[model samples]
Target chain A: MTHKSLITSLIVSGWLALVLVGGCSIKTRALLFDGVDKEPPPPTTRVRRDLLAEIETLKRDLADAQKALETAKAKQQVKTADAPLPTELAKSWVELSELLPKHRSGQVDWGAALQAGTIRPQAGLDPTVLAYAEFNLDITLDRTKSPTMAARGLSAVKFSHAAHSQWLICDNCHTKGFQINNNGTDNILKHDYCDNCHGTVAFAMANLDTCDRCHLRLP
Target chain B: MPAFSPLLFALLFITTVANAAPEVMGNITYQRQGEQVADGTPAAIFPHWVHRVRYKCYVCHFEIYQMQAGSDKASMQDIIAGKSCGVCHNGKIAWNIKFDTCSRCHRAEE
Candidate 1:
């Protein structure tokens, strides 16, 4: 072969060799990327499985919490339904006075028996009449007797009848006094009772401020 | 970006205007003076609305509470269970009385 032709053939051969090396390097890089891509599948699948497990656990916890809440609410409802009547008045009466007067020996006449009678007329009679009648009978019957005797007689009256003991006790004790004296105010009555009975036999009446149930005026 | 969504901005503005303390409501300051068995160092600022709902004026004004504003000598412990605030605030119906919730009912000053 000629020298020039031989030189051109060598340069062409060198170029061809460089191109082949570059192609091999690119193919190696592509193979490396393919291997790396295969590695992520196991970890990604595990993460997805873990997330599903967590979701199931959360759902179970929520169901348990809801069931516990329902049980507690049902128990509370049953307890409230079975509770007794809130007879604070009856409780107060028993604590303040329970025994009746066998004999009379004081300023008030507790020996006198309460006579059945209709209540007198007064302002706001519908609310106050029943209370008034009860007080009048209690006061008159025990006019010349001790406080103990009066309390006993007043307490002996049955509370079943609205115009009887319930009416009387609410009026004479819880409501305003029958007299116009300043001491007859509901506030005064509660104070006097508390001073006498607190920490003694009856529960302290110091906090009873709801007197409108018996007294017509706002006082 | 928009400063705030239209709905969010409107809600924030309404809440700011409506939550202001009432102007006409009267203030209440209660001095201890050793009337209560528990801590008696500082007085309380009782909100009138707290009592108005459960009881009538007669309950406190002429009966349990004296007509005179400063005449009452109630203490913190005086109304824990069913005495003062306890009459209605007993744990069953209202807030439970405890040291954690002290500021809700008793304020040292105003």
Candidate 2:
């Protein structure tokens, strides 16, 4: 080959080699770690590690909460097992029995009974109705052995005269005694009876404002 | 080939937003405490949300009912005649306490 041609070829080859090397370097650098150092991806990696640590912490917290819940449940079970049974209703039953006329001998003049304080009128209750309740007490006390007989006597009475009082006083009378009406029923007392009488005749009983009259407040 | 894709980025953003958890309603039921005054009867059904709206937490939690759930002693007679929750739940204020309405407060056994 001629010297001129060889020189031209060498210069062109050198220029081409420089361009290719520059292009390759730019591509390789861009592909390798162009934005890596700029953004400090190590911080992202650290964040991922922190997230994993947080997840582990959350799992630990969840486990601790579960254990605490189980402990609380166990303590509650123990407390319930050690607790005493409630006997409020039983005591009330005894008090009611003591108030029955069967415990007293001789005829009870309901009108005089109220005057003598043998049967006190419940607060917000009608005095006349309370007197009628005395009559019911006399019959029930006389026929304690035969609930059927007592019920029959009660049913036979012209309850219309003191129907309001009967309903107010013995809301649970049938519920507590009669198997047909109150058998296996808890709180056999009917609220409708109380509402009906209280709503019509006695204003105190109407709004449930006189609950404290019969029941003592709990401390 | 193009190195960036706008559509891919938009899809990824949409997926992340859709996966967020939803808020739940606050309606909850609580059990009653103490002995069963009446056997075969379920515990009272306390509507948490309904009560929460009427009064503050302190009313029931501190003033009336204890903070601990199922720790108060309530009787059916007391409630029907107006006591405890029945003080407000009486027929005039809220629902009537009739034989048919027993199931409203006394839910069936689970």
Candidate 3:
């Protein structure tokens, strides 16, 4: 082939290989190191070496953890005197918890008690509606200034005015328990808003389990 | 009997019309935040019928708020400081700010 023709062929192949990158991300880099001459992959040769170094660090952590456990056990021996084994302590709590009903977060699953006819709350706390009521309002609290919450997969909050109004008067929250609207949800996260009662009267927020109790799927 | 029936129908129409009085209707929208409103800043909504059901016009007339909507520009800052809405929402007569979500009053226009 002519020199100019050969040069043109090289340029065409180079453009095709560059297009194989697919996207400007490390994920696309996976296609490169295969010797396809697409793009350079992240430093692959060091990955295994770095992981081996991490294993050594992890071994030291395990040894330190075991030593800390032994020291804690020695301290416990002085307090209990009988110093029950860790397995024995686990059995005791398991047996004790078996007596109480199942729970989701800190909140109890009242479904079991209500079904068994075991619970009978007073008029103030009762949820059953025996008579006609006055005001009716149900609001979904979805406002949040924190951009991280949505990314973290947290759903909006659910509130029912009809339920609370049965036991409490408007004076209980008009400007006190809550505002009409526009109040940021930051207070709810700080354990000051909904947590005021939920943490004490009911189950407080308990990790991801608490998310199911309040942030239900938006239907 | 036929003459009296026409007279009774006329009397009923007058009674119904007299009972009806002109009044400010529907909800009052407060978008005083002004042009270029974003998604989350919030708008203050004044639900008229809900309050009119319990209190008279005097409850929040020229005293608490002006007779017109544009006359009042109650912002969140003003409400929190015990001005426009804070007077009653100070945890005494009504609930205070820390009680619930701010969206209670500050909601996007429907």
CAPRI accuracy category, model 2: incorrect
- Candidate lDDT scores, in order, read 0.43, 0.44, 0.54
- The first chain of model 2 has a TM-score of 0.24
As a whole number from 0 to 100, the lDDT of residue B25 in candidate 3 is: 29
Error of 1 at A128 (Å): 19
By the TM-score metric, which is better: model 2 or model 3?
Answer: 3
> Residue B109 in candidate 2 has what lDDT?
23
Q: Write the per-residue lDDT of candidate 3 for residues A1-219, one digit (tens) a residue.
A: 699999999999988878766554655575555545454546776787789899999999999999999999999877774443232232222342343356665434433433443333223112242423535776776636434455565677667666555434554444543443445666666654555445433355656766665676632
In terms of TM-score, the best-performing candidate is 3
Q: Give candidate 2 regions above 4 Å deviation.
A: A1-219, B1-39
Worst 10 residues of 1 chain A by lDDT: A113-122
Q: Write candidate 2's Cα lDDT for B1-110 as tens digits.
A: 14557777878877764563221122223445446544657555454423322232333433355433345666777777677767766776467778888886665321
Per-model clash counts, in order, read 11, 0, 25
The residue ranges of model 3 lying beyond 4 angstroms of the native Cα positions read A1-101, A110-117, A124-136, A143-153, A162-167, A177-180, A217-219, B1-110
TM-score of chain A of 3: 0.39
Alpha carbon deviation, residue B53, candidate 2 (Å): 2.7
